[model samples]
Target: MADIISLGIDTGGTYTDAVIFSDARGVIAKAKSLTTRHDLSEGIAGAADAALAAAQIDSREIRLVSLSTTLATNALVEGQGQRVALVMIGFGEDDLARDGLGEAARAGPVIFLPGGHDVHGRETPLEMERLQVALPQLAQEVSAFAVAGYFAVRNPAHEQRVRDLILRDAGLPVTCSHELSSRLGGPRRALTTLLNARLVGMIGRLVGACEAYLSSRNIAAPLMVVRGDGALISASEARLRPIETILSGPAASLAGAQFLTGLDNAVVSDIGGTTTDVAILENGRPKLDPDGAMVGGHRTMVEAVAMRTFGLGGDSEVRVDLAGLIARIELGPRRVLPLSLIGHRFSDIVIPALEKQVGSVHAQRNEGLFAIRTGLPDSMAAGLSAQEASLYARITDQPQPLTQLLTTAPQKSALDRLAARGLAHISGITPSDALHVLGRQGQWNAAAARLGLDLAARQKGGNGKPIAADAEDLANRIVQRLTRQSSHAILEACLTDDGETGIDPAKSRAIARALDRQPGVVRFSLALDRPLIGLGASAPVYYPAIAEELAAPAVIPDHADVANAIGAVAGQIRETVTVFVTSPEEGIFLLNGSGETLRFVSETEALEAARARAIEHARALAARNGLAEPHIELMEDADAAEIEGKRKLVEARVRAVASGRPRVAN
Candidate 1:
């Protein structure tokens, strides 16, 4: 039997891609299957089955399996997450609705109490009786809970106390904001915790499914999920903080793009069936957007590659202005054409059956018998009648011209007849109205099929239909315009602070408005001299072409279709823990923990304490990350200032390093 191999799978919007890698065979095999969003496990199982079969390996020979998913991200974006509750130990009701925190709180219930800590490690006093009363009152309704405090990062004791209280009384999963982030901003930190809470159940189930799948395949190795930053962490850790995986898809693509292009700097355009994504990479690293990015409609602060999305793709609904005579805009690949054009090319059920039953519209002599009907305007009908004799004379000699005439002047009633054809000639409905319905909410496949027939009956060609040259130009223009606008919005968001003046919104808006210049100035353009590469099936169709047209060398990589899965395959385990502290006496700060008194007499001591804490955190994470006998290091900082009689302060930083056993050859 072949040596055991690692399996990686990524579930995307349209497809689930799986890859197998073996030391002996190098890259063993890769497989793709349609994604079943209704039940992701179906798509995963199908992809896995295909990949294993392609590699010619028995399920028992598989050593490990890992998955990179966009499920959690999707759930958050589509507002399909569980109803969660936010518990604040010492925060006001208003805190839950502050800045980034407001976005997460919007997902569920929020409860605030009087118990908390001051800037120093001292307690701010709590209404314990009220908390006890509230815990049971709030517990039954929420599936998950998030607990955050004003200075939880500096002193998590109060937060931990609140968590214990909630856990004992509510029996619900709880995430403390301080544990998730060491950042100073309370609202952002709280938001991060709330997001983690909301995704807890979804991620847990997803990870559980993967685990079961792996065990069934006899895979013994541990599993790891890639974070939004393109780094890896243990499945257990990922389950706790699923928000980190929100941007893993794009990050992985950027990573894969970096690997493929071998360039230090460039811009990448990744276009998929649903949307087009553009990002800039410098020194082989995608820039991380610290401020929250909007996914679907909500904002999340997950580490993600900064990218601009355009609602334009091969499957985009092409809009046409049938309403106006002067300004008719032809929209879309909105009409996803049926494969019946070649006439019974395949045995694909409906489309094939439809073509056989109705015959070709181009071949029919009777206008009413034709499958492709036309909805002609009064003006166009007049023109057609004036040229009727000439058109009829040329029909046998120049059928192509006759067809062109019908394209320009379609009859309205014929459209209704065409819609009734059903399985005869129009099976795949591709209409702008149908596309709008599909894009909005529910499945409109049936409606789409009907609309496709109606569209076929409409005038095929008009002044609204642009030539191929004009289409290419238009695609490029749309890409440029959307990219500039989204990027400018992000830049403007990044610049705004509590009070400090930054990027002027009006100026940014002006820049976004004038998007006509090809290769125009982006608020944040990459060094394209080095080339930016894109990954994903649609990246080639949308990104690379746009980049090239913009005078930038762009590369859309092979296997870009499954780069996210590849990222899952090539990641390492990681973890992080953050503890907070507050000031006590003048020039003295105290750590709020369970153990010994970690007091900082000066700023140096406070900084040292933070470093030591960070190192300890990394070591613990290393163990969870499957690192045996993990080594560690520390780095830290303290923010302190004099106020009245005492110096108030806070401490923070990170300590991280790699630690893992070498893989043994079989």
Candidate 2:
């Protein structure tokens, strides 16, 4: 058999990576380009073209193409998804108070309907007059709709009706709670569907852009997308159910780590410009979160890899905390546009502004920072407060120094509100600038970086002393702080996997002393049981120290920077179907999920029927999604209780999984 070729692409917060891979030769060529937030296709095409040229291979020879991305995860973490209208059946506004639903619904509006099902799949009289009247106007406000009904999993009649109504009337995308998860918690499921609706248009744009690029290049191949579970799905599935791809980039990186290291168990860490993702691999597979994946403190019912996403990255906003007698450095829980990047892009504007700030004898409170209008449309800026609107009207494509931008007392709060809404960006001294100052990274303007760092260093701490002696000193401190935070993130992830939760490695006294490594009678140390495999372009510069701090061997393999792209092409397709059987009374068995409910007289007969149906459902789904010749496996879990010398059936769950290696396009 001859080797088959595949092209893989991964879009992240900072860079878009592309790779050309062979089943027999492994990675042949890889490249990266800056991610253009406004138009992602530009970045994807640039990296793909570079990789294809490097490999010297004809595009037609590529039999497969796969993609993974961090846009969804980043949007959820940064609170930047599109507006969505939520329809809750048999749920009132009070339901929004549970599971942080009200806060999650901050991006859009909610509607309540008097329709739903009971625990046993009994229906309530549905009311559609309100929704019918609001559909026309809502279409102008929101890009998508989410439908959730009480006990929808038991009987999704009301949810399906609402979905059909939205699609037929508004013609916009719709997400239903029951389709996402069959779990019993109505509020949590609604939260998941609401998030899915918010992300639909964003992910849809990404996938459509990639497809358009492929068509333009005459590269006709099977298009696949990496799911959050590190499995492959057709791009069509990604378009309809993008929430499943929340952690797509991180999951692909985990698979890439396994492929590069060939390790059975290890701690994997990937650092990008916007965030750092850490996960643990057990027996060569990243563990799946059983309770669902949580991002940005919002627990969503999205089944994804068990990983910790920290907002500490290269472009993280670097701030000096002056709380105590000694000043401390703090990295970001929010990302910002790097000063060096903006300086390089608009050197005429940003560089001159930075120079003016550094040379002025007058010290400004917002020194070394600038505000630039984010490229979002004007419609998203609607309903801004009077002050926010005033400040926003002044910000333009040209970077405005923060010192002048926030002249009034109320303008400061207005800028914060604007930034929170993703209407403007604060460009300041970030770790990327620090790296440029230290001469480790030179892709951007170094002079601007030096000036920015010098301005930040001159600031007085709580002790009324300068934070650092010079730019070089401040740069080193930032890098060291990143290293310490990275180590703590990795340790925190590992500890969480070991059933230990809520232990802050960064603040723990013993752990801090251990990482600090200062001599003392009560000395402490930490060591990992497995090696640390690092991925990302910055891994080479950052992970060595992180691994050393944890006393673990660092595996910085070849092509580490493009690992996510490599993993996108290196994975297989997986489809799963779950069937549930329950007994509301003796001598009666009911089966539901994946299809209409059925009744059986005997428990044994119901279990047999459920297992067969599950396998059939999985096989049918895989084939529909372009998986060729899938092999299916079945697992059954049954529950029962003993009472009065007889066993009573409670519930039984049967799951079938189908998987197979990806096949070449015909």
The best candidate by lDDT is 2
lDDT at residue 412 of model 2 (Cα atoms): 74
Give per-residue CA lDDT, model 1, range 1-666, as digits (tens): 566478878766456788887646645788887565334566778888898899898776666566777655544443445567787777776665666577657646677777665555556776667768777766656677888887665567777787888788888888888666655677767777887887787677667767776777666777777677677777888787787777666666676566556666776655444344556677767776665555544455565666544443333333434454432333222222222221122234333343433455443322212232212111212112334423333322111211233443443233322222110121232222232333422232333233233333342334554322332333343344334433333333333322334655436544334333425355433223445465665454445444543345656677777766766666555444444455555666665432333776765676567657656767767777666565454444556676697756644443445455322223
**Would you list the C-alpha lDDT of every candidate in the order shown?**
0.55, 0.88
Model 2: per-residue Cα lDDT over 265-288, one tens digit each = 999999988889999989978999
lDDT value, candidate 1, whole model: 0.55
Candidate 2 residue pairs in clash (backbone atoms < 3 Å): none
* Candidate 1 Cα deviation (angstroms), residue 77: 3.5
The top-ranked prediction according to TM-score is 2
TM-score of each: 0.68, 0.95
